[model samples]
Target: MKLTSYWLDTVPRFTGTPQAALPGQADAVIVGGGFSGLSAALRLRQLGASVVVLERDRVIGEASGRNGGHVNNGLAGSFTDACAKLGEDTATRLYKVLNSAVDTVETITRENGIDCDFTRCGKLKVGNRQAHEAALQTDYARLTVAADPEACLLDETQVREELGSDLFSSGLLYPKSARMHMGRFGIGLANAVLHAGGLIFENTPMTGMKRTGNSFEMTTPQGKILAKSVLMATGISRNAPAWFRQRIMPVGSFIVATEPMDEAAMRRIMPGGRNVVTMQNIHNYFRATADHRLIFGGRASFSRSRTTTDITSGNMLLAAMRRTLPELPDVKIDYCWGGDVDMTVDRLPHAGQWNGVFYTMGYSGHGTQMSVYMGQRMAEAMAGMPDTNPLAGRAWQKIPCYGLASHFLPLVGAFYRAKDFVQEMKE
Candidate 1:
């Protein structure tokens, strides 16, 4: 199997890269050309701002391209617990904004006419063990009452009908969840930015930045830019701003894609055509592509990303896929890869200004849509619409005594595994 992203391999490369040398002056210079940075450029142009996007790699080359293509409108963690921790009013507002982010992604797909197979196929949060079923029911109860009236609980029999899998005991179905071809969406978003007269510099990394009077001066490998403001939409790259690095933890998420399967096999395993995710501290998510290929992904381990670990993770994911769907025997993995996901202490996205730089990060594993929303919001914030930011005025919590690498990941993974073992025993 190729150690590359199936999404990136399937879509055409973005050809509209800017050929001009980086301008000495721009209204805004965006760091990182993932979904957040690209979407921000599109919105900033609509607001009549001259924007420049600087990407260290190809646009959407990192976690944005390597993801499982879930535009799911759910929180990364439990909603009821979030309400209990932050109070219902605060949590409800944040939850609703994330739900709106899903709507924003669908709206963009429609408005741009991007043929990314954007589908509101809904989402199924399935329970692997018995106690997990109770948790799913709890999430269904709280979410339906708080944010989504379209959410509901499904028993084992109903889940079996929907998924044809005996591994899950129950599920929580969120009807607003969606999926799409992320690579195509990324290219489409890049075209949108270009169509709006924005400049994109692929393979250009921001090397340095300093305050120059009213504007910030950013030095890239190819050229430099002076901007009235800067947006740090950089994903979980180890080379990022110091302020951002302190608060964000880069966790490696791994995935493997099976070769295109027959329509009959797709129908037998996943009749509902929804994203299926099991409830676990270290979760496993699987869904079929528009081409009928099953893409399975997970936080296979808490260790940092490496070639060997990616292959090992792919093997583990294949085993999990078989356990979930015994009907798919001898499945051939066509692709395997890994990328870093930026996570926060609270596991919620934060958008605000640090010094002269506007920024957003900590999407955890739910960035597929929320990052896009934060991009639009960052544009609004830069255009004097600070209230548009859903995660406004939130303080970012930093990791203790760690920088760059998460040295304690294996210990954290072991703790979660032990907890899972205990939970399984209790069940």
Candidate 2:
């Protein structure tokens, strides 16, 4: 099995335009060449702003390409709990924003004619424990009444039909949730930005950024760019800016892909071809690729290294998958990879500026859709329409003791694992 991202390995990397060269100045400068940065750059170009995107490595090769290929809409937490925490009106607004993100992704793919196999295949959220059955039911009831009209709670009969495993007691389905080849989408989005007259520079990491009299000066390893506006789309990488270090915690998420499954096994396992996610604090998410390969991933390890620790987590995922589907006992594993997710204390995405830089991040494992939509919204905000962004004025609190590194991650993981074990024992 190749220890790499199936998405990044499969798609052509976007290395900017022909004869890609760094430019000196632009109307707007964006750091991080992932979906968020490229999408924002595309929108900025549409608004006739001269834009440039800077990437530290291969475009979208980080968490963007390393994700589980889910464009699933909704919040990280349950809608009912979200309403209680964020208030009814605010939570509802946030829910709609996530829904709008799905639309934005579809619109970009359609309008730009990105052939990334974008499909509205829906999402299947299942309960890991008996308690989660009631949890899904409660969430579904609240959802159907207000947020998602198409969401429905699945009983045991329906659950058995949807999932091969009888371990789950109940499930919830969101029809609006979609899936896509994220690597292709990233390349397509980057190309769209270039076609719209934006410059992208890969392998260029921003070393320093400072506001200098009505413009921002961004210094990179290769060259520097002076811009009237700056967008900090860079996530939890090693070179994260000093100011952003305190606000975001870098968490490790891992994935492993199984070799192509037989047609019979594929049909029997995930017949509906939906993104399947476990309803656990430390959850497992799996889906079938168009090529009939199974991509299963989760927060298997707290360590963020791409090697050793990543391989260890991949083995854990393989064991988990085998336990879930004994039918795939002999299936050969083909790929494995890891990426860093920007998690916030509140588990909600934050946008708006700190100092003079406009930014958006902290998706907390729910980024694909929100990142795409918020990029356009931030573009509109930069164009003098702050009302377009619902998360614009949201407060961003720094994680306590998360200044640069998460030293207590091991303790945190242990606590959650123990809690989950207790819940399982109770059931």
Candidate 3:
């Protein structure tokens, strides 16, 4: 099966737009055309800075388009783990920043009139097994202590009522979270950036970047751009500058979208069309698309190759979905695909200056909201304000093994997967 985004193909691409050429010089240069790069371009333009975005492929052509489209709250790691790694004070600040990112994405979609099917439907973190439920309880307690009191918990009955699936024993509800048509959201964000007077060059791959004086020079096949500051938002591309590859590891995550189910069948699976993520170590994240298809995603591989035609591995994913809702045992998968997520070792995103360049990436699977928020933070930082805003300063300290782990991910990822499997069996 060819990897096609149902959400992306349903919407029209940005047509009749003028192609942007590489400028001789710019105030800022942003690499990657996904949510992070485009959002950063828009914010920087809003701040009256001359910005240019160079993308290797068409905008949202990778993970940003290929994801499951569940835009939820917080990072991939638990609050407790984050507190342990980053200390209590910094971890609390980071949670608040990510909490605000959920709202920031909503605000941008509405204010820009982007028809990306943005919805504030709450997310349910469901737990299937007893150990999973126990972990959720711990997570709930930690989040409760660090988050707004309004974010509450749900028992088994409430979980089933909300999700219409008996697989979950308990749930944690984060009211501030949301879901959007991720492909369309990325496209709309690019359009918003262009409308805001920023330059976006699609199909322009940044080959190399060199620091010159206080600025950076970025080279592409067709042209080159010199800028005062650069933002390297390319998540998983190994072709990224050496400095970027040091702090980020690209981990492959797969997603399979089922054929549109009948309205009655859809109602039976998800009552309110809310997004749900499981508590398993190799977790499953899913949601109902606007077209009434279930977008189920999970299972990670360390490979970087783009081969979307393996139905055997997809069967495992479908089986996982069946565990969540037995009613969907026979649902045919319409599309199966996978993309790489830039993961940091500690599971917290890294954002700060590398040498003289300002950059942000490595959101794990939590990029949907955090990418946009980090863009705004980058813009603020470039505007001569350096207070280490909530998200920026919290995780600036790189994990000890982040650099080494990212470079040799193919070897280390197997160990991580083994650990997850062992943990699941113990449960």
What are the RMSD figures for all models against the true structure? 1.5, 1.5, 2.9
Give a tens-digit lDDT track for model 1, residues 108-215. Answer: 888988889999999999887877777777877888888878888998898988897777888889888899999999999999999989999998999999998998
Q: Model 2: how large is the Cα RMSD against the reference?
A: 1.5
Task: Give the TM-score (vs. native) of candidate 3.
Answer: 0.90
Candidate 2, residues 1-427, lDDT tens digits: the string is: 7888999999986666678667888888888888888889999999989998888887898878999999998777899899888887888788888899999999999999999889998899988677888888888888887788889788878877887786777889988999999989989999999888898888889888888899988898787789898888887766767667778888888899889888778878886678899877778999988888899998787664545787789889999887776566478889988888898888888888878788888888899999888888888777776487779667788888765347778678878978888888887
List pairs with backbone clashes in candidate 3.
none
Q: Give all TM-scores, in the order shown.
A: 0.97, 0.96, 0.90
Residue 177 lDDT, candidate 1, scale 0-100: 88
Least well predicted 10-residue stretch by lDDT in candidate 1: 299-308
Instruction: Show model 2 residue runs off by greater than 4 Å.
Output: 303-306
Segments of candidate 1 deviating more than 4 angstroms: 301-305
Tell me the deviation in Å of residue 85 in model 3.
2.8
- Model 1, position 338, has a per-residue lDDT of 85
lDDT of every model, 2 decimals = 0.86, 0.85, 0.77
Clashing pairs in 2: none
RMSD to native, candidate 3? 2.9
